[model samples]
Target: MRREFLFLSILVPGPDHPKISLDVFLQPLIYELQMLWEHGTEAYDVSCQQNFNMRAVLMWTISDFPAYGMLSGWTTHGRLSCPYCQDNTDAFQLRNGRKSCWFDCHRRFLPSDHPYRRSRTLFTKSKKVFDAPPPEIDGYTLLEQLRDFGANRTPDCGGNGHEHVYGAGEVHNRHKKSIFWDLPY
Candidate 1:
């Protein structure tokens, strides 16, 4: 039993350090944004902001981590994706129905699974629904457009921060809209 459980851990990502709760990693990521706002105008802070300390929120995943070590299902970059589809899955899903992988990579990192434990409430309520023919919400597929736009570069290919209004780039990033992206026409 311990062996089996251990094996699974390698395939997922979650907080291993008891004191370092899953949410702890989010601090750097979040504060980085605040710092950017406070000092982004200066050329020095601009480069630091680009690194995005808060990016951990977007890069974390459970499959890539273990309770104390790894088991399997890791990528060359130490990332884990949906075993079935091989697509990167984030630790958190958007409330409206979007995956963290698509969201974070655009932010420029991956979602760590710790948030799911910390924000289990929001995570569960926003659970993604998948159907054979395909549910009205793909939740998982949102990354397709993100990759095309951000080129999967944290904050996505067209990294312009939150200003990336859907269809704002009608002539450029004309990614189709879904329940997740409610933009003004």
Candidate 2:
């Protein structure tokens, strides 16, 4: 919904050379990059004098997939929208049956022993319990690790290793190569 504008200022003012719109000059380049991103192996050419190999291709932009799609002339919505998980998403149908809602959360990435890694229910609302506390790898708990790695402040920890840092309902759409980070390795 946000609109962005690019201004190509002219140093020398003249009516003979008319002003050129930014998109008119940039669209072809964007299209070429999109082609390279989607079909790099086929679109890449050796004579182009630019590297478009697998490593170089992977080192492109780091924006969310939807933003990438917007730049590439691709629409993103519905069930198969998530570029990382794709169809493996945890989205569910709505009451109207026409659309679905996505509820990807922190629980999916939490360790099994982490107290926040549980489905909430009415019975457990009054007094939540945990079988084990979160592991302290290399004498530092997750809270300490997060603090050491500059998270501003340590999350509030309730006895059984429950830390309320990220909300349970918060969406974590960023790509993660590894979820199990028992650090100091």
Candidate 3:
């Protein structure tokens, strides 16, 4: 059976509503799903034999990058906006206290395991800035170095315990809120 979650009224204005932002619509939907998952039933087939345990309810949401960032509770802009490599991203602080990353398309040419991948401190602190050697390994050969981290990547480590995937601290009005920084959930 197909199912859908009604997030808001269709009568509401379209994108031009100004007040109707993507996150505004999704936050309630996500909260409802979280509530349902905590107190909901699993799908069962009449013809199939029932087991002792109830089936687990799982939800998967698909959206574009901006929407995904809103749903996942991560920064979408600024130097630290990159959810994957922000921990190791090389950025410099401006007089205004905002960080600006030096984005060079040439860095993509570097190997996945290169010291520069983890942090930019290596290159920035070096004496010779312009002088650099060609990467010995190609991108295709360096895929092994890439490993997925974060709660989204490994949902069930099955060790310590479990936690809520979606949560927040003090919110900024109804439209903006601080997303929990731990995991996507």
Candidate 4:
């Protein structure tokens, strides 16, 4: 609703970021959220002086780009950084910066008859975007994909001297199964 109403649920003491280990911290919160969503809790109304069932739902989360990656279990790096596009991303590495750039990647989302789709000078020079935008993936499909990546199967505690493989060829940007997916909704 408002910035003042937003409360910090968890805070990681920082010298280093939590990275993949963030999922461990989120497990408890996910459990509580599941309970609130399913069974809810009893509450008293002050003015009416009545007892009622209080339920809560998490609509979405707010975070910076890097933190979003951690929370969503998507790696916001490399050529396939956009979670929406996934493997269909049209990003390329910059020649000078040595970083991935998504320049002119959004043309496919425009209408087929849009003038910019046929313009050579507007976006990438001498290129026309006739391909359709990436297909939208659903939650169940995403969970199936994550099952292949072996995410959410075990605790993701760091410093175990074992390397955790991310994306694993099947998915380009997903690093792990997000804790939010555990919710039935």
What total of clashing residue pairs does each candidate reach? 37, 0, 2, 0
How do the residues 68-182 of candidate 4 rate in per-residue lDDT, one tens digit apiece? 9888877788887888888888888888989889999988989999999999998898999899998888987887777776655225434222246555433566766677777
- The lowest-lDDT stretch of 10 consecutive residues in candidate 2 is 174-183
- Candidate with the greatest lDDT versus the true structure: 4
RMSD of each: 20.1, 20.7, 13.2, 3.0
Encode model 2's per-residue lDDT on 52-153: one tens digit a residue. Answer: 554212223344655454322222566545544443455666679668665532244456665555556632344343433323335244344344333221
Model 4, residue 158: displacement in angstroms?
4.7
TM-score of each: 0.20, 0.32, 0.38, 0.81
Instruction: Tell me how far candidate 4 lies from the true structure as C-alpha RMSD in angstroms.
Output: 3.0
- What's model 4's lDDT at 104? 94
lDDT (tens digit, per residue) of candidate 3 on 103-159: 542354466666554555655443223324343544333222221112221123222
Better of 1 and 4 by TM-score: 4
Error of 3 at 90 (Å): 2.4
In model 3, which runs have C-alpha deviations exceeding 4 angstroms?
1-12, 17-23, 49-60, 91-185
What are the lDDT scores of the predictions, listed in order?
0.31, 0.37, 0.39, 0.77
Off by over 4 Å in 1: 1-20, 37-41, 44-133, 136-185
Q: After superposition, how far is residue 56 of candidate 4 from its true place, in Å?
A: 1.5
- Candidate order by TM-score, decreasing, is 4, 3, 2, 1
List, residue by residue over 3-30, the lDDT tens digit for candidate 1: 6634312211554342213223333444
